[model samples]
Target: MTLPRFRPRGWVAATKAAQRRHQAEAAGGPRGPAPRSQRAALYVHWPYCEKRCSYCNFNKYIPRGVDEAAVRSCLVTEAQTLLRLSGVRRVESVFFGGGTPSLASPHTVAAVLEAVAQATHLPTDAEVTLEANPTSSPGTRLAAFGTAGVNRLSIGLQSLDDAELRLLGRTHSASDALRTLAEARHLFPGRVSVDLMLGLPAQQVGPWLGQLQELLRHCDDHISLYQLSLERGTALFAQVHQGALPAPDPELAAEMYQKGRAVLQEAGFRQYEVSNFARKGALSTHNWNYWQCGQYLGVGPGAHGRFLPQGTRGHTREARIQTLEPDNWMKEVKLFGHGTRKRVPLGELELLEEVLAMGLRTDLGITHQHWEEFEPQLTLWDVFGTSKEVKELLEQGLLLLDHRGLRCSWEGLAVLDSLLLTLLPQLQEAWQQRTRALVPGG
Candidate 1:
C-alpha cells in the first residue's frame, strides 16, 4: 500500500484567519433539540503489571499473593455504579487501561464488559480499547479478547531496541515485541496501536527515527510517540539522581521529536495531537474525548474523572478520583457502594483553566461553541480579547485568533509551557472578576 506525504508548508498566519472563521461557523450550527447523547467515554483501570518497568510512574502493582477474584469483582461493581451515576444512555467509547489489562483473565474482562453493555447502551460500533503489555502473550488470545468485546488493542512497546528495552527494565525482548505486534495485526487487522517513547538515557535521533520507520511496518495506523519523563517516584528517577543512569538531554530529545514528526507525516499519519498520530479514521476516540474537554467516567484504583453533574445549574464541573490502594478501594466500595476517595466541585475559573490547557494540547484548539456548551454566559474572547499578552502572542505568530476562537500554532505548541505562563493569567483575572460579580456581597 502506498501512503501520501504531507507537507506543512501552508500552515501560516495568512490562512489561519480563514480557517478559524470556518471552524467557528461550522461549530455554531442549528440549535435544535438533539437526541439523548452521552458525549462521554468510560475508563476502567486495571492496576496490575506482570513486571513493573523502571521508568513507569502510573499506579500499578505486581500480581503476587493477591486476591485476583476480589479485585476483578470490585472493578465490575465500580463500573456498574459509574454507569448508574452517569445516567448516560449512549457511550461513545470504553477504554480498559492499566498496568496491564491484558494480564487479567479473559473471562473477567468479558464479564466486566458484559456488565458495562447491560448497564449502559453500548453500541456495537463503539470504540472499545484494551491496553496490553507486549510481553503478555496477548496475540495468542486476541481472538478470545475480541470475542469478549475489545475491538482495539494498544500495546506498550516503549522501545524496539533490545539494549534500550533492557535499560528501561522491559520484560519483553525486541523479537518478542515484534512477533506479538505482527500476530495482533494478523488477528485484529487494522485495530492495533503501538506506543514508542523517545529520550531514553542514551538514545540518539538517528536510532530513534530508524526505530519509528521500522515500527510502522508492523503497526496498523495509530502511534503514540511520547517523551520520556522521569517522574519523582520512579526507579529510573532514583537511578538518574544517583548517577547510576544518565538522563536524556532536552535538546537531543527535541531533535528526536521533530524528526519523528516528519517521518510519521511522510508515512501518511497526521499529528492530530501533540503526542499522537493516526491515519484517517484510526484516531483513538477515547483519548480524543479527553483532549476535547468532553466528559468521562473513570473507575478502579487511582483513576480520575471529570463531568458536569446531572442537575447542576452552573458550569461547575465535578472531579472524582477513586482510592489508589486496591484493598482500600474495595473496602470503600463495599462500605459506601462506590470507591470515590475524593470528589471536588470545580469552580468556573478552574473549569476554564482546564478547558484551555487540555484543548491547547491538540491541533484543533478550542472554539467558542465548545466553551458556550458548558458556560453559555461567557466566551473565550470575552476573557482574553483585551489582554495585551494575547495580542502580543498573536502578533508574534504564536497564536491564531479570529472571530471564532484561539489556538496555538505549531510553533506555539513547541513552547506551550512558556506560552501558557503568559496566556492563562489574563483569562484567570477575567474569571476572577466574573466570579466576584456573581457573589452578591460587596
Candidate 2:
C-alpha cells in the first residue's frame, strides 16, 4: 500500500500546469465562478516541533527552544483573518495539525481557539480536533483546549515496537507512547485517535498485530494505519535510494494489511476507509470532508486548502498555500496576509482523480456512471468500461453501486486501483476529446 511510483499521465501534466495556473491566478488572472458549499472545514497548522522526525515530509520546523507565545500569536492572527474572509460565520469543523500542535502551551492553544470562536459562529458542538505527539504531556493540556472549544485529539504514535520506532527515527519510545495514550484517554474523556505506520523498512506482522491489540486496549475512537511511503525529497527516500534502508517487501506488506484489518474488525473497529478505521460514527470529520470533496481552508506555513466559491460548477481554488519554513512564514505573514507562492486551481480532472483514488480505499464504491460525470458521457460507455465490466464486478462482489456513488467494498479494495486502471485509457481519451472541444482551432 505504498504510494505508487507510477504517476498517471494526467497527474504529472496537471502538477506542472497547476504551478503555472497558480502563478497567473495569484496575479488575478481570469477564472470562472467557483462551486459552493454551505459549511466549510478549517485547518490551522502548528509548524513548531521539538525534533524533526526523519520520516516526516510535511511542513515542519524545529525550535531551538519552545516559543509558545510567538506561535500562539501567529495562529490567532491567521485564524482571525481567515474568518473575516469566509463571509459566512458558521464553521463546521476545525483541525489543528502539524509539527506538534500539542507543543503549544494549553493557554496558548486556548487563545487561538477562543479567537476562532470570537470571529466565527462556530457551532456549539463543532468538531474541533488537535493533533498531538506522544513525547509531550498533552493530557494536562487537553482541558484548556476543551474549555476553549477543542473536542477531539489525533495523536501521532507511528509505532509501538521499540526496534521499529528506532528504525523510523522517532524520539518517543514504545513506553512513552503507551503511557501518554493512557494519560490522554484519562484526561480528555473525549474522542481520541492514534496513528500507526505499517510496512516500515524493517517491519514484521507479529509486532504489528501486538501493537494493534495494545492500541485497542485503550478503546480509542479511531486509528489511522498508513503504509510507509518513501516520499520523494524526504530523508527516508534518500536512505532507501542510497541503500541505507531496505525496501518494504510488497507481498509481506499485503499480508499485513489483510491480517491488520482482520484484527481490527475482531476488536469491533470497522474499516471505514483505507488507512482509517474507527468505531461507528467516529470517522475523522476533517479528513472525511477531504475525500468527499468538501470545501476547506488551510492557514499557516506549508498549509494547503481547496475552496469552491459560493455558486459555480466544477470550479475550486487553492487558497493561501505557504512556505514550509517558519522564519520565512513569519516574514511572509508579517508583511502580506501570508504571502503565499503556491495556490493553484484544482481542475475537474484532478477532483475526479482525488475522488476515484480516495473512494476506492473506503467501503464507499465508485459509481458506474462516474465516467459520464468525471470525463464525458458521450463516449464513456465505450471508452473506459463496458456495461459488462461493471455488471461483472458487481456480480463478483468486487464493487457496489449505490445512490451515494460507487464504492469498493471491503473485499473489492484489494484490487481497487487495478480495476480503475483498466478503464483509464477510455477515461483519458474522452478527457482529451473534451479538452480539444473547449480549445477550438487546435
Candidate 3:
C-alpha cells in the first residue's frame, strides 16, 4: 500500500516587520492566551556537513572557508532570542540536530548549552542529545562532547554493509561505523542510540536482518530504524527516476520492517514510536516531547519550531522556521536577533491535524488530557468519537479508542496515512461546528 506522506504546512521565514512586532509583543505588550505548558524542548540545527549524502534532502551545505566562530555565535544568539520570545523558563530536553552537529567544536556545544542555561532553567538531569555521524565522531571527540554537556549520543550508522554504505554515499566504511559505535558505547554507556536504515535499493530481507542482528550486539539502549525514503530532489531520487538505480521493493521493505521489529522485541527493545525502539528507561525524552506535541524552540538555519506565541490571546500556537541559507541566516540573526523567516499561527483545525499527525505516530496516542491541554475547548471524543468513520475504524480493528484515548492498532500503524486521510476531514468538520457554536448569534 502506498502510504501518504504528511508534511506540516505554513512555514516561512519572518519578515522584518513581523520580527519587530513579535519582539514588541514579547516585551510585555498586550498579553494573549498562554501556551498549554511553559516547559519546552530545544532543537539546535547545525547546517554544515563534511559531505553530502545521496539520500539527504535536509537543509545542509558543504562549507568552504566558512567562519566557524561566527556561526557558533549566531547559534548562541538565536537560542537566547528564541528563549526570550517563547517565555519558556524550563527546558525538558535539548537536541542538537544537524547537517552534522558532530562536526561542531566541543567549545561551540558548551557555549550554546551555557546560553540556554542562562536564559532558561535546564534541569540537571535533562536529556541533552547530539546527533553524530560515524565519520565525524571519533573516540576523543565523543569524550569531548560528553564533557561539553551532551549526555546522549545518537550516532548515524545508517547501514552496516560496506557496499550499501558506499551506495548511500556515506564517507564512513562499515568498520568505521562499528568502531564509532564501540567508542560511543564506552564513553556514554547506556546513553547511546544508533540510527539504522532499512529498504535500501536491491536490499534483501535476509541480509538486512543479518545486519540488524549484528548491530543489536553492539548498539546501546536505543535504536531508530527508519525505512529509506527517496525524497524528491535527492540524488537517489534522481537516479531512480532516471532508471539508473532500481527502486526498493515495497514488499521486501515491509517484510524487513516486520521482521526487524520482531528481532528488536526479542532483544528486549520496545517500539515506542513507529521508527524508534528502546529498552526500559531508555526512551528518547526529546523525541517523546515532539510526538506529544509539546512546545519546542528551534535555532539555526532551516530549523522549525512550534510554541505558544508569548503574547497571543488564544489557544493557537505559532510555527516558526529559520532562514535556510547559512550566511543569510547569520546575517538576519545579526540584524534582528533571530533568523526566524516566518511565524504562522496555527488555526484550530491545523492544530488538531498536527496533534493527530504527530501523536498517532507513537504508542501513546492522543490522550484525553493531552487533547484537552492542546485544545481545551474540545475533548478527543467530542471531535472524533462521534464520527461514523471512527466507528467503522474501531470495529475494523484499525483504531483503538477507550479510557486510554485514541490510537492506531498494530494493523492501523502500517496504514496510518490511509487512516489519517479518513480522520482529518472529520476533525475539520468538528472544528467548524465548534466555531459556529461559539458565535453569539449562530
Each prediction's TM-score against the native? 0.88, 0.80, 0.90
Worst 10 residues of 2 by lDDT: 1-10
Q: Write the per-residue lDDT of candidate 3 for residues 43-127, one digit (tens) a residue.
A: 9998888888999999998866567679888999999998898888777799999888888777677778777766766665779
Residues 260-332 of candidate 2: C-alpha lDDT, one tens digit per residue: 8888888788687877888867888778777666667777778887764444445544445767677777677
List where candidate 2 sits over 4 angstroms from the true fold. 1-38, 86-88, 232-245, 309-314, 366-396, 402-404, 423-442
For candidate 1, lDDT tens digit of each residue in 1-442?
1111111221132134333433443555433332333546889888877677888889988755556568767888888887677666556788999878877655566666666666655655778898877767555466556656678999888888999898889999888899889888887788888999999887889988989999988888989989999999888999999998787899999998888988888989878888989996788889989988778888899999886656666556689999998888999888776799888888877877888888888878888888776568877878878788899999999898876677888778767788889878887788778888899993
Runs of candidate 1 exceeding 4 Å displacement: 1-39, 309-315, 436-442
Whole-model lDDT values for every prediction: 0.78, 0.68, 0.84
Candidate with best lDDT: 3
Please identify which of the two predictions, 1 or 2, would achieve the higher TM-score against the true structure: 1
Report the Cα lDDT for residue 140, model 1.
46
lDDT of 3 at 242: 95
